[model samples]
Every structure is written in C-alpha cells, then in structure tokens.
Target chain A: MTAKTHSLERMIFFSDAVIAIMLTLLAVELPVPEVPDPLHLWGALAAHGSEYIAFLISFCVIAATWTAHHMLFVHVSRTDPQLITLNLLALLGYVLIPWASKTLGKVPNGAGVIVYATAMTFLGATMLLVLRHVVRSGLLDPTAPRGVISGIQAWSAMTTIMFALSIPAGFVLGRWTM
Target chain B: MTAKTHSLERMIFFSDAVIAIMLTLLAVELPVPEVPDPLHLWGALAAHGSEYIAFLISFCVIAATWTAHHMLFVHVSRTDPQLITLNLLALLGYVLIPWASKTLGKVPNGAGVIVYATAMTFLGATMLLVLRHVVRSGLLDPTAPRGVISGIQAWSAMTTIMFALSIPAGFVLGRWTM
Candidate 1:
C-alpha cells in the first residue's frame, strides 16, 4: 500500500466541515433563556449576559481565524503529510472553542478562562507553525504576487502574538476577554 | 444588490464547517463525571454510558449525512438559489442533531427520542428534496455516471424512509433505538 497525495479541494473540504460544525455549535451553547412569556424574553436573555458575551467573543474569534486560514490557502495549491497533520492539530483547538466558551461562561474566572485561552493559544501557535512550514517548504504557488508571502508572514506573526497575549489576558481579565 | 452565484468550493466549504461544528459539539454534551483520582475514571465514565451511546449514534448519523452530501456535490458543478436554500434547510436540521441527542440522552423516552428522530426525519426528507431539485433543475454534471445518479437517488429515498419510520419507532422503542 502507498500513501496517497490529497488534492487541495479535499483538504479544504475536510477543514470547512470542521469549521462549519464548530461555528454552529457555538450557537447551541448560547444560553437559551426560558422566556415563559413574550414579556420576559429579552429580559431572560439579558440575565445570561455572560453566556451571550462568551458566545459573541468565540464567534468573532472563529470567524477571524477562518478568514486567515482561507486567505492562506488562497495562495496554497498543494499539500503534504506534515502540513495536513499540522492543520489537523489546529482544527482540533478550533473545534474546541465552544467547550472553552462554556467553561468561561460557567466559571468566568482565571481557572476557567485560562482553559479557553490556552486552547486558543495552542491554535494560534500552531497556525504560525503551519505558515512557517508553508514558507520553509516552498509551498507557495510560484508566480504569485511578490507581496503575498510577506503579507501572510506578517499577518501570522500578528495573530500569533495576539493569541499568545490572550492567554495572559485571560488571567488578568478573568473571562472578560477571549 | 444582485444575487450572486456561488462556486462549488464555497458551498462545500460552508457545508463542511457546519458538519465539523455539529460533530464536535456532540462530544461536549457527553456526561463527564468528575474523577478526582485516576482509579475511578472508568467507573465515572460508565455512569454516563447512555450519554456515550447517544453520542456514538449521533456521530455515525452525522458522518453518514456528510458522506451523502459530499458525494452529491461531487456530481454537481454549480448551484442556484433553490439548491442552496434546500441545502440550508437540511443543514438547519443537521446542526440540530446534537441538541436533540442531548435531549434523548437526558430523557431517554418517547418524548425525547421522537424529537431527535423528527430532526433526522427533516434532514432525510430535505435531502431527498435536494436530490429531486438536482434532477429537475438539470444540475448534475453531464458526464456523471448514470448508475451513480440513480444510486444516490435510491439511497436518499431509502434513508428518507428509514428516518420517517424512526419517528414512529421512537414511540414503539421508547429510546431503545437511535
């Protein structure tokens, strides 16, 4: 038996499946307040403010991460085992955002918030690794714009730092920040 | 604004994201018992055996649904408003599976299992609608194998029947079946 090369389409299909699942799962975790009546609907939701906030924050985080991932692949045309493996790891944490969001909602302290941030931290750090692999392994599509490589690197660096900083921020903000 | 045409890539990507999110969210709802010591791990987990069972059933359901979706799109090169809309409706039910599974896990009766089965029934029915839409709208790739198209239709029809039957079976079996 031989290891088969995967097309860019399949890889993207797999990744997209994972992300769609994660994004929609976030909505399920959104605190569905027991309204009992129309008058109490908005009030009940407002009561679970923390849950709403956590949901919104994680939603934005996932959306932004997707943009970055999508943009990176816009320039990527092929894949290897290592790159796919690295991507799977990132997707692991990406899918975990909701559970982490739950921890934040329930605990909303250094203990719980750190767990969420740590997961994001892992995602960010691993994303940077993927970017580095792409560049170091010469994965970029040749004849691409000269500025594209530097653009990706700079974006990855910035997001990596932001995610790294989020870890410490979780400790300081105590679930107030994602 | 004009209605925009969607590429197959974007459609697949969107579908993938939703599936991934739903699949992973099922895991989060699995009853996680507090095991302060390593020795009690198995026992604690065993206490939530039913949840695990539900998780397993739902996971398989989601995986099968994804396979069908991926396969269908393989023969589809382009899409229109109706197809996308039908797929969206199907996805709505797809994303609801985990939540219904949670209910089934907790209640484990006609009430809960029926709700779960109802969602699947919706998915199964809507999937057939998508299939029919594809056939009627002339959306299939011209070169697609004749056997493949018929096979998909037969599969969809059968699954839809099974899902429809499951709704009543939910009452008869009273949570014994998924």
Candidate 2:
C-alpha cells in the first residue's frame, strides 16, 4: 500500500473506533429496572419505556451514520488534513449523542428534546462537511461512479436539514418531536 | 473487491467497532471526585488514586490489544467462519474488561484482581487462537513475513502466560497484584 492509503486507513480506523464507542455508550448508563418481586419485573421494565425508546432511537441514528461513513469511505482512496479535521469534528458531535440520549430519557422535556436535536444536527452537519471536503478535494477513487457520489452527498444534505429543522420542532412538539 | 474481501472487511470493521467500544467503556463509569470547595479538589481526586490507576492500566491493555490485532490483520487477507467466531469470543472477553476494572477499583480484593487477570488472559489467548487459525488455515497473504507472524504469536503467548500467573499472585499479594 502507498503511504497515502496507509494514512487513509488509519483515519478510517480511528473514526470507526470513535463511532463504535459512541454507539455502545448509549447503553452504558441505561437503568436496569429494579423490582420488589418477580411478578413486578415486567411492570418495572414497562415503566422505563421511554429510556428504552431513547436508546433504540440513538442506536439507530449512530448505526445509520456509521453506514453512511462506511459507504463514503469505500469510494475514498486517500485523505487530506482538512478531511481528517472534519472527521474529528464530526466525531466530537457523535460523542455527545449518548449524553443527549440520557438527558432526553431523564427529562423528556422541551429542553431535553432540543439538546438531542441539536446534537444530531451538529453530527449530520459535520458529516456533510466531510463529504463535501472529500468531493471538492478529489479524494475519491478515479473510477467512483458519479451517481453514487451525488447520492451520498444528497442523502447527507437531506439528513442534516431534517435534523436542523427538528430543533425548532422540539419547541412546538415537545418530546413528540423525537 | 471480491465477495471474500468484502466479507473480511466487514469482519474487520465489526471487530474494530467492538474494540473501540470496549476501550471507551473503560472511562464511561469513572467517578468524578466530588469536593465541597475548590481547595479540596486535588485531595478529593487523590483519594481515588486506585481507580485512576485501574483505568490507565486497562486503557493501555486494550490499546495494546488493538495494536496487536491491527498488526496481525495486516497480514491476513481473508477470514473464515471459525476465525470470525474466535474473534467474537475474543470480544466477549474484551467487553468484560471495563466491568473487571470497575470491580478492581471498588473492591481492590483478591477476587477482583483475579477477575481482571482472567479477563486479560482470556483475551490474549483468544487472540492467539486467531493468529494460529490464520496461519494454519492459510488466511494470511502469500507475501506476509514469517518473522512477523511468529513474533505476534510469541508476544501473545507470553502476555497470556503473564496474566495467568498473576491470577495466583492475586491471592497472595492482594491489590498489589495489579
């Protein structure tokens, strides 16, 4: 492998590590329902339904983000310092996801919803920046299909816009905005 | 990429995710020392010295494990089902490292020490098994260096032995065994 390929691989590995840690962090603090008796187990678990839902939602979001990252990197043949910086910035937002999920689970209020939405929006926006950097810098493989490249960029842009819009919806819809 | 390379890539990505998650989980439950005033902060932090040490040790161990895995996989060009299974088993042991670290930090007893040591030994042994599988099953690239392969196996075996020996020392030395 060329030095460029090796550097790119390291970047991808580091990003994957951060993404994985954030994904699993969603469950690290999930409360295990305590019950007085065996019969109360189901009832106690049912009471923490919101926490479970929060976990599920964050898990899906992180997984989808990882999928997008994996697909984009498949077309990428090299990396630049700017792209690496943007990737790190994107990871900074990802690392906040679990904290946002926890706040939403505990409060389920307008503020909590806003926090979660903002984190998601930041993550998507940073990722979009990375995609744009990759495209503008000609870092992708020479043979990469035009349709695939545009498709990824379009999807990233749309996701970022949706999350950005959700911030305001959090004020009007409360927890329902999630 | 051929189907085989794609499958191997997926396996490597999944392993990287699990390793990253486990590494970050080491810090997830770390206690932030509470103090009544700013002046008492250093003293309060110093009180949890063992916890800090445990965290540092586990972090290094996990990071070293990841480095070894990366080095080994650089020679491996494909994966088999048994190799995948062994990798998962290795991850199961790795996922226990954070819990073991927590126990050692909290209790600092023989049992806790033994738990931590055993987990480390299991991880090393399983990774050694992966190396052996790769070599025996011809999963490595044809151009892979023989010296590099044996060096990894030798290091893994030595580390596993050291951890196994520590289990007995934990009985006699208590927390100092760490």
Query: Which candidate has the highest lDDT of all?
Result: 2
If you score just chain A, what TM-score does every candidate get?
A: 0.84, 0.92
i-RMSD per candidate, Å:
7.0, 8.5
Per-residue lDDT tens digits of candidate 2, residues A1-178?
7446865796688677877777767887889998999999999998998888889999988887788788889999987667766875776577667766876676554555666788789989999899889988999899888897788788888888887887777666653544
How far in Å is the alpha carbon of A71 misplaced in model 2? 17
After the best TM-score superposition of candidate 1, give how far the Cα of residue A13 lies from its true spot, in angstroms.
4.5
Structure candidate 2, residue pairs in collision: none
Weakest 10 consecutive residues, lDDT, candidate 1 chain B?
Answer: B32-41
Provide C-alpha RMSD values for all models, in order. 9.2, 9.0
Which lDDT tens digits does candidate 1 get at residues B62-138? 66566566556667756888988998998898888888889877876677768877888888888889989988888
Q: Return the lDDT, model 2, position A173.
A: 61
Best by TM-score: 2
lDDT of 1: 0.72
RMSD of 1: 9.2
Local lDDT at A161 for model 2: 89
Predicted complex 1: CAPRI docking category: incorrect
What TM value does chain B of candidate 2 have?
0.93
